[model samples]
Target: MYVTSNFTWHQLAQHVGGIQLQLEEKGFVKGDVLLAITPHSSFELILVYLACIEQGVICALVPELTTLDLDKRIQTSGAKAVFLCPNTSLTLDGALEIDFALEQGLETQNYSEQNLTSLIFTSGSTGEPKLSPTACITI
Candidate 1:
């Protein structure tokens, strides 16, 4: 069951900062891609997403991906790492698994909409899935 909890603004900001620190420690820098393959969504995932944005790392969120699917994503996106929920039983090879706790910290960076921030895969009517990247730019 998904349990909802209340979080103050301060808590959220700190969590995001902690996540950013973790990402940096793991050698993930701006323009690097991270593939998150988990069956379910949780608060941690949201924090990671925010952290990636703050750090200028592109995050690709995948739901319940199989090994083959995971391989395709890695190849297409050139993801430097994969993130799994701490409680998950899945294991991956040839990719760094990032597991970090959200703690207290703060590090702010400028984010431009012109730079790619996230990636998604879209299936068309009659072909292989295509990668769709998102940026912050209005145009």
Candidate 2:
């Protein structure tokens, strides 16, 4: 949860949690899809994933995707929103639902597993990737 160069884990979590609630306020509900196209290991990447989990949004972490490919992926995934990290250069010009890094926070919620928590993107070296949604049920 290294949000900033020096922020503590709790601090980063709090900030991301706020963003999650804000997204919820903006209509991110259970099983909605959110596209995150950052380096898979970056802090913003994980933060967004956690937030999506809190609000029941399915997060798709797809890296190295072309702009057109991303658009196709979003379409295929039925994503309700998109999150472009600070380091991401790809743009979704005509995307139906998209978001950049939020500088604000909102009310937060505890982690509750949703019906669909994440999506896996599959593509060969030659074409647009397809997304398959999956949910992990705790026993």
Best by lDDT: 1
* Backbone clashes counted, model 2: 0
Off by over 4 Å in 2: 1-9, 94-110, 124-128
**How badly does each model clash, as a count of residue pairs?**
1, 0
lDDT of 1 by residue, 10-119 (tens): 87787788888888888888899998776777767777888888889998887766778777778888898888754456787655544444565645574677768789
Q: What is the TM-score of candidate 2?
A: 0.73
> What local lDDT score does residue 67 receive in model 1, on the 0 to 100 scale?
75
- Candidates in order: C-alpha RMSD to true structure: 2.8, 4.0
Compute the lDDT of residue 98 as modeled in candidate 1.
Answer: 44
Model 2 lDDT tens row, 14-125: 7677668677778888778888777556766777777787777888887757767776877988887777766666665643232434545555554565367788888768
Which parts of model 1 are misplaced by more than 4 Å? 1-4, 86-89, 94-100, 108-110
- Candidate 1 vs. true structure, TM-score: 0.82
Q: RMSD (Cα, Å) of candidate 2?
A: 4.0
